[model samples]
Target: MTDDLQSWIGRTRRVADEMATPLVRRMAALTDRSDVALDRGAVVPNHWLTMLFDDAQPQSQLGPDGHPSKGDFLPPVPLPRRMLGGRRLTYHAPVHVGDALERETAIAAITPKVGRSGAMIFVMLRHTITGPNGLLAVEEQDVAYLEAKRNAPAPPEKPAETPTAEWRDAWRPDPVVLFRFSALAFNGHRIHYDADYARDGEGYPALVVNGSVSTLFLFEALLRRNPGRQIASYEARTMQPVFCDRPAFLCADAPGADGARNLWVEKDDGAMAIRIKTRLT
Candidate 1:
C-alpha cells in the first residue's frame, strides 16, 4: 500500500516561467490595495503568489468536491479529502513584479500516521522559486489527506484562559471574503464557498475557511504589532479547520529570547486553528 504511494515521493515538475506583474496587480486589487503602484521591478509581498502554476484540467475532470481529480501530479491517495497542513518559507530575496519566474516542485516526503481522530496521509512538497536574479524563495508545504466524513473529536480542554494578550484582534470572515479570496487565488475547492457541498458532501459544520487566509490574518496582525519589522523567515502549522461562521482572533506572545515571535489563531470556540512562528531582520 505504501509502495504505491511512495512512487510519488521523488516525482518532480517544472512550471513554465511567467511574468509576475499582472498577477501582482490582480492580487493587489483583490485585497483592496488597487491604489498601490506596482512597477516592473517592484517587490511583491510575502505569500502573495499562491496559485501561479496550477494544472488546467477541464471541467469534466473535476471531482464532486470541486477539485481536480487526483493522480496527475499528486498521488492518488484513497482519502477523499485534502487540506493544507502547514508551510515553512525562507525568503532568500525579495520577489519583484514583472520578473520572469519559474517554480520547481518535488514531492519531498509522504508519511502515514494515525492520530486521535483516524488515519492520515501527509504529503510534503519542496518548492524552489527562481527569478532572473536567481533563487528567490524556498518553501516546504505540507498537505494532509483524510477520510471523508470522519468526525473530528472535540479539542482537548485548555487551562484557565488568559485575561489578556500582548496583542489581539478579531473578525468573522463572511462568505464574500471567502469568495473573493478563492477568485484571487484561483482555488476551486468547494469547501470554501459552497455551503451545501461543505456540509453534506464534506462533513464540515460550516463553510471551511481557506488555510492561507488564517495565515494572512495572523501575518497582518503581526505587522500591526511590530511595525517596521522585516520578516526573515516564517512557519505555520494548521492544527484544525477554521470555519467561516466563526470569528478568528490573532494572538501573539512576547518576543522570545532568540528574537522569534510566536503567534496563533484562536477560533470562536477557543481552540487554536494554527500555530505560527516568525523571525525578523
Candidate 2:
C-alpha cells in the first residue's frame, strides 16, 4: 500500500468511526420490515461500508497532486456504470430490532473486468456482523462498474428457496418510489442523490440508486407480503447496480424456523440484486 493511501485510510477510519453508531441506528430504522410482534432489532448500513473500507486512506492521497490509489474506492468510477450481471441471494436468518450488533468489513477482491460493455472494475466486499449473543451473519457483495450505454435487459433467472415457518405475501418495487427513501436514509453516495455526478464522476448513464435502499425495499416487500408476521433476522448481499426510474421485483419465499429461513431478492431483469433469509418469531 502506498503511503498516501495508508494515510487516507487512517483518516477515513476516524471520520467513519465518529459516524458509526448514529449511522447504524438510522439505517436500521430505514430498513426495518414487518409489523409483527417479534423481538426485531434494527440494523444500520454503516457496518458494511465503514467496516469494509476500514483501512481506506485519505481521499486526497495517492500522489503528489493527491490522486487516488488502487485500494481506494474505484478512484471515482464512471457514473451510470451498468450492471452486467449478478447471482442469487441467500439469507442465513432475519435481523430483529434492538439487536446490538458489531460489524467488521474487508475488501474481498478487486478484479479489473472487461465485458461486452467495456473496461470495468468488479469490487467484492465481505461483511461480518455479530449480534449481542454471538456471530449473527456474514455477507458477500459484488459491485460491477460496467461501461455505460443504452442496452437490452439482462436474461431472467430463478429465486432461491428455503423451508420456512410459512408462506409470505409477494411484494413489488417500483423505481420512482426510492426518491423519498433516499432522502430519508441520508445516503449521500451521489449515485443515490445526484444524476450529474453519476454520469460525470461515476461514469454511469443514469442516476444510480443506493444498494441499501434496494435491500430495504425488498425487506419491506417481505413484511407487506406477510402482514402481522414479525421479522426476526435478515442478511442481504448487493450483487448488481439498480438504476433509478426503472422497474424491479422482489422475489421472496416461505419461512422455516426461528433460526433458519430461505429468501432472495432480485431486480427487474431478474438479477440477484440481493439474497436474504429471515427467521420469524
Candidate 3:
C-alpha cells in the first residue's frame, strides 16, 4: 500500500492537469444548467473546474467478482466510501482550450477519526494544475472512508415541506447532464452512462450517478437553507452509488464545534450518499 500510495501521489497530480480540456468541452454541452454559457474559446467556468477536480487515476484492479475489493483505491480520491470538505474556489485564470497542463500533488494528511460512524481514515490530497501560461486550478480534496459501515441514526421526523416560494427548478437529472459531467471529468467508468454496464459490468442495479453533481446539489442546498452564511471548508463523502434521475434529499445543519456546517445527503432508500462538513464564516 505504501508503494501504491507513492505512485498515486504523482498520478493524481497528472489527472488534475489533464482534466480541464475535457471538462470545459463537456460542461459547455449542458444545455439547461445555468445562465452562464461557456464560449468554446474561453476558459471553463468555476463550477466546471470544480466538477473536474474529481478526476483521479486508477490505483488498483477490481476484485474477481468485479467490485472494488477491500482496500482498492484505483480511481482514487472519490472512493466508494464517503467524502467531505470542499469549499470556496477562485478561478484565477480561465482554463482555455488546448492548454497543456500538469498537477503538482501532495499527500496533505492522513489520520484516524472516531465518530458516531465509528473509526475512519481521513486522507487529504492537494492538487494544483498549471496550464501553458500559469496555474489553471488548485484544489485540496479531503477524502475519508469509515473503517466500519457508516449508519446515521434516523432523524426525528419533521413536518411535510409546505413551500413559501414556489417549488422551482427541475429535481430530476437527465441523461445528458450525467453524460456531460462524466465526459468533463474524463470519467470512462461505465456505471454512469451504460445501464447494462452498471448492472452487469460494475454491479449497480441501474446507471449509477456521478458524485460531482451530488456535491453541487449538496452545496446548493447548504446555500438555500442557510442563507448569508459562508462555507469556509466543505467536505463530502460518496457513501454509495447515486444514479441519474433519482430525486435527492439534502440536509445542512448548524455548525458543530469544529466551526464547520454539518451537511449530508442520500438517494431514495436513504443510504448515506454524501456526508459533508462545511466551515462557516
lDDT of 3: 0.53
Scored by lDDT, model 2 comes in at 0.48
Q: Which prediction has the highest lDDT against the true structure? A: 1
Please give, for residues 175-201, the per-residue lDDT of candidate 2 as tens digits.
Answer: 444555554443334555567766666
- Model 1 regions lying over 4 Å from their true place: 17-19, 30-36, 151-164, 225-229
Q: Write the per-residue lDDT of candidate 1 for residues 1-281, one digit (tens) a residue.
A: 45789989999988865646767776676555544458877666655656466655688988777888988888888888889999998878776667777889999999998754567899999999988888878999998988767566545545334334578787687898888778766688999999999989988889998988777667766765555554678898888788886777888878879988778888777777788888876
Q: Model 3, range 1-281, lDDT digits (tens) per residue?
A: 23344444433434434433445545545533343334445543333455544434344544432334434433243234444434323334555555556666666665556554455556776767677778755666665654323344433443333222212233466677777766666555566777776666544557766667766666665555545543444555555556677776665555557665556664566455656655544
Off by over 4 Å in 2: 1-100, 147-187, 200-205, 227-241, 247-281
- lDDT for residue 6 in candidate 2, whole number 0-100: 29
Query: Against the correct fold, how does model 2 do in TM-score?
Result: 0.51
Q: How do the predictions measure up, each by TM-score?
A: 0.90, 0.51, 0.54
Q: Which wins on lDDT, candidate 2 or candidate 3?
A: 3
In order of lDDT, best first, we have 1, 3, 2
Which candidate model has the greater TM-score, 1 or 3?
1
